[model samples]
Target: MDMIADFDLTAHNTFGLKSTADRAVLIDDAAMLPELAKASAETGRPLKILGGGSNVVLAERLDAIVAIMRIAGRSVNQQTTDATIVTAGAGENWHDFVVWTVDQGIAGLENLAGIPGTVGAAPIQNIGAYGAQLSDFFQSLTAYDLKTGTIETFDAEACRFAYRQSAFKSEPGRYVILTVTLALPRTWKAKRDYAGLDRLPEDATARAVLDHVVALRASKLPDWRVLGNAGSFFHNPVVSAEAARAFEDAPQYPQVDGTVKLSAGWLIEQSGLKGFRLGPAGTYDRHALVLVNHGGATARDIAALATHIRDKVRIRYGVDLVQEPIVL
Candidate 1:
C-alpha cells in the first residue's frame, strides 16, 4: 500500500468534512500488519484504526498514521440442529455481514441491519438498533494485541458489553479485531419486543424481521449518500427514574426501564434547530438528530452546529446531549 502524506480525510468520513491525515495506510491484508507496525515503531507514531467512517467527526487533522483495516473473510464453521456458527473478517462491511447472514438462512442480526460501519468496529461499539445489538448474536472473536503483536481470542463475557459501550471502545488502540465469530440460529428468533416491530405476524421469522426493519428505517432515516448524514448524531441521554418522573407531567418525555430516556431528536426539534443550517451543515428536517452535509460543509461548520445544538439543549432542557459519533 502506498503511504500518502497529508491525505484529506473528509472524503473518508461519512460527514464529508475536509480534514487531513498526516499519514494513512489501508491494510487490505493482515500479513502486512507487522511491516506497518515496524514502520510506526520507527516513526514513533501510533496507528489509528478506522473502518467505514460512519460514526466519527473529523475535528482536527489526525497527527498519527491511520491504519485502515481491510482484512476480509467469511466462513460458516458449524451447523447444529438449531443454530449455525459463522465468522466474519474485520474489514467486511457491517451491513453486508447482516445480508450475508440472512442469505445463509441465519437469524438474530436482522434488526441491526443498515447500520453504517465495518464488522470489526461492530464489537468495538456493541452497536445496537431496533431492539438488537451486535452482542446478542456474538459468540467470540480473535483480536490482535497491538503491543504483543499476537492474536488472542476473547469470548462474549470478556467483551463487557453494555447498551452502546464495549471494552474495545473503553480501551481504544489496544487491540485490532481480526475476526468475529457469531452464533446464529437456523430457526427464526426475531427481537420484535421493541416497539413498531412488535406488530409482526404470528409466524414472523428472521427474514420477516429483516424486511420489516429495513422498511422501518427507510421511512425514518435519510440515505447518507444522497443527503449526507451519519445516522443518529447524539445518543439517547439516559437519566434517572426520578428525573423521568419530573417530566412525566410534561408532554415530551418517555421513560425506558427505570431510567428516563429522552429523544435527542425531540430535544433538537424543540429547540427549533430542525432544518437549521450553519454553513451547509444542517439538521435533517425529517429527523432532528441527524445532521446533514448539504454540499460544501466544512468540519468547522459541522462542529459549530453540534456545539450550538448541544448548548441550546442544555440551556433549554437542563439536559446535556452527548455526541454519539467519535469526534476526532
Candidate 2:
C-alpha cells in the first residue's frame, strides 16, 4: 500500500489544527483495507481510521499510520411498500446524503439535516440532532474487522446504539465502517419533538422540516469551514429527575424513563462564559455550547479552554459536562 510520510492534517480535521501523522494512506476501496491492515502490523505502527474529522479534536502529532477512509457510492438497495433502504459508502458527505434522500422523497432523516461528517461516522456516533437520530432509521451497516481483516454486518441491535453513542464508538479501532444502509419511510412524516423543530408549523412537510433544521443550525452554529469548531462541544447533561428539580429555572427535557436532560449551553451561558476568550480559543459568542478557534489556535489552547469551561460548570451547578468530540 502506498503511503505519504509526515502528512499534514490541517485541512483534514474540521478544527483545522496543525498536526501531522507519522504516515498516511488513503483507502478509496474497502477491498484494499486487508492489505493496509497487514502493512500496519508489519510496520509495527498503530492504525487510526479517520473519517470526516468533524467530531475529532487533534491534540498533537500522531505517531500512528493514518488510514483515511475514502470509499464512495450510494444506491437504493430495495424498496418496500412503506420503507426504502438506501445504502451509502463511508466517504459520502453526510449532509449531502441527507439532502439526496430528501430529494428522493424519502423521509425520516430530515431532522438530522446540516450535520457535518461522513455517513460511516454516523452510526459510530449515533449522530443526532433536532428530534431525529441516525439509529431511528438505521437498517444495517457493513464494516471491516481490523483484527481478523474480515468484513462484517451489524443490525441496529448489534450496533448497540444509545444517545450519541454506539458499539463502534465504545470500542474504537476495532472496526472500520465501510457502508451504511438506512431504511427511510416512503410516507413522509415531519419530526418536530425537539425545541427548534417543535416550533415549526403543524402542517410542516419533510422538506419543510429539513429547511427549518438547516436554517436553525446555520443560525446557531458557526461555519466550521470559516470559523474552526467541532459543532456542540458538550453533550447536554442527563441527570436524575430529583436532581433536576434543584435547577428549576434551567431548561430541561424529561426523557421517557423520567430522567432529565439539561441544556449545556444554558448552563455555560448562566456561568458567564459566553463570549469568553483566551487568545483564539474560547466559547462562541452566539452559542455558548461551541468552542471556537478564532484564527491560529492549537489543540492545547482549545483543551485548556474546554477544561476551564468544564470546571466552572461543575463547580457552579454540580453537573459534570462531558465533551462530545473524540480527543485524539
Candidate 3:
C-alpha cells in the first residue's frame, strides 16, 4: 500500500470537485486491506474506499483515510454449456472491461458499455444502462469485509440488487469489493428494448451494440474528463400509479410491481431548471438529468445545486428526486 498524507482528491473524483483526504492509500492488492484497516482503526479514522471515482461527490475535505482501490486482473474463469464465467479485478475500468468482453466474443455486457466507474463499483448501485443491468450478468463477487476482517464471496441473491441499489450500498463502507464475476451468455440475443437500442437491427452483434451504446452516451452525456460531471445525477423516481397520473405529459414506464417510473430529467426540465446555473454548478444544457461543474465548483456548490433541483422538482411534481452519485 502506498500512502500519502493530506492527499489531494481533486483528480480522483469525476465531479472534479476540489477535495482532499487526511490520508489516502493506493490499494493495489487485496492482501493490503486488513493491515490498512488495522492502521485506520488505530488512528481512529474511518476507512473509505474509492474506485475510479466516477459515481461520487466529494466534500472539500474528508477526515477519513481513503483507500483508492487499484487491485487488477481479468480472466475467463469457467466455461459452461450455457454461459462463460468471466472474472475481473475490482479496479478495472468498466468501459474497457466491456470492450474486452466484446473483443473476446463475449456478449451480455454490450448494452452496459460506456458507463464510467470501476467494475467493483457496479454492483454497489446495480449499474445499468439501456436495457440491461449489472445484476443481469453478475454471477458472484469477492469482497473483503471491513467490519469482520474476512474475505467473503457474495452471489447474486446475496447482493439484493434493486434498481440503482444493492446491499453494498445499503451498508456502505462495510465491504471492499475485490473482483466481479459475470456469466456472459454463450448464445446471445440482442437486447433492444430501450429507446436508442430499439433502433438496432434484430441481428445486431455485441460489438455493434457496444458501439451504438457508446455513441448514444457520447451524444447524451458530457465526458467527465472534459466537463466535470457524474453521468446521471438522479435516479428516475418510481412513484405509485395514482401519483404518476398527476403528470399526464411526463414519460412513464410502468414497473412490474405496478409502480410508475417517471423521467427525472423531464421533471427537472419542466420545473425550468435545465440549463439553470448557481455559481459554478448547473444542470447540463444538453441533458437535465446530469449536473455539471462549469469550473472550479466545490462540493458545497454541487450540493446546493442538487438541493435546488430536488426542491424545485418536488414542489412542481410532488415526486422526490434522489441523487444517483454517492455524496462523501
Candidate 4:
C-alpha cells in the first residue's frame, strides 16, 4: 500500500471537482487490503474505498483514509454447459471489461457497454442501462469487510440489488470489493427493447448491440474528461399507477410491481432546466439528466444545482427526484 498525505483527488473523480484527502492509500493489489486495514485500525480512522470515481460527488476535503482501488486481473474462472463464468479485478475499468467479454464472444453484458465506473462499483450501484442491469449477469464477488477485517464473498441474494441500489450502497464504507465475477450465457440473445436499440434486428449479434449502445451513449452523454459530468445524475422515479396518470405527457414504463417508471430527463426538460446553469455547475443541454461541472465547480455548486432541479421537478409533478450519485 502506498500512502500519500494531503493528496489531490481532483483527477480521481470524473466530475473534476477540486478536492483533497488527508491521506490517500493506493491499493493496487488485494493482498494490500489487510495491511491497509491494520494501518487504518491502528490510526483509528475508517477506510473509504474509492474506485473509478465515476458515480461519486466528493467534498472539498475528505478527512478519512481514502483507499484508491487499483487491483488488476482478469480470468475465465469456469465454463459450464449453459454459461461461462469470468472474473475481473475490482479495479478493472468497467467499459473495458465489457469490451473484453464481447471480444471473447461473450454476449450477456453487451447491453451495458457504455456505463462508466469500475467492475467493483457495478454491483454496488447495481449499474444498469438499456433494459439490462449488472444483477442480471451477477455470480458473486469477493470483498474485504472493514468492520470485521475479513474477506467475504457475497452472492446476488446477499447483494440485495434493486434498481440503482445495492447492499454496499445501503451500508457505505463497510466493504472494499476486491473482485467481481459474472456468468455470461454461452448462447447469445439480443436485448433490443430499449428506445435506441428497438430499431435493431431481433437477432442482432452481441457486437452489434454493443456498438449501437456505445454510439447511443456517445451521442447523448458528453465525455466526462471533456465536460466534467456524472452521467444520468438522478434516478428515474417510480410512482404508483394512479399517480403516474397525472403526467400524461411524460414517458412512462409500467413496472412488474404495478408502479410506473417515469423519465427523469423528460421531467427536467419539461421543468425548463435543460441547459440551465447555476455558477459553474449546470444541467447538460443535450441530456437534462446529466449534471455537469463547467470548470471551477465545487461540490457545493453541484449540490445547489441538484437541489434546485429537484425542487422544480417536485413542484411541477408532485414527484420526488433522488440523486443517483453517492455524495461523499
- Clash totals for all candidate models: 0, 0, 0, 0
* Candidate 3 RMSD to the real structure: 0.9
lDDT of 3: 0.92
Q: For model 3, state the Cα shift of residue 244 in Å.
A: 1.4
> What's the TM-score of every candidate structure?
0.92, 0.96, 0.98, 0.97
Off by over 4 Å in 1: 249-257
Clashing pairs in 3: none
* RMSD versus native structure for model 4: 1.2
For residues 1-328, could you state the per-residue lDDT of candidate 1 as single tens digits?
5888897787788877777888988887777777777887898887888898888877557887887778899998998897789999999998888888888777778998888889998988799998778887889999888889988999989999987788887788889888999888676656778878989976787788888988899999888878877889998888887776655534343445666677878888989999898888999988899999998776688889999999999998898988878766
Candidate 2 CA-lDDT value: 0.90
Q: Worst ten-residue run, lDDT, model 4? A: 29-38
Name every residue pair that clashes in candidate 1: none
lDDT of 1 at 195: 76
Which candidate comes out best when scored by TM-score? 3
Instruction: Report model 3's TM-score to 2 decimal places.
Output: 0.98
In order, the Cα lDDT scores of the candidates are 0.83, 0.90, 0.92, 0.91
User: What shift in Å separates residue 202 of candidate 1 from its native position after superposition?
Assistant: 2.4
Task: Give candidates' CA RMSD values in order.
Answer: 2.2, 1.3, 0.9, 1.2
Error of 2 at 92 (Å): 0.3
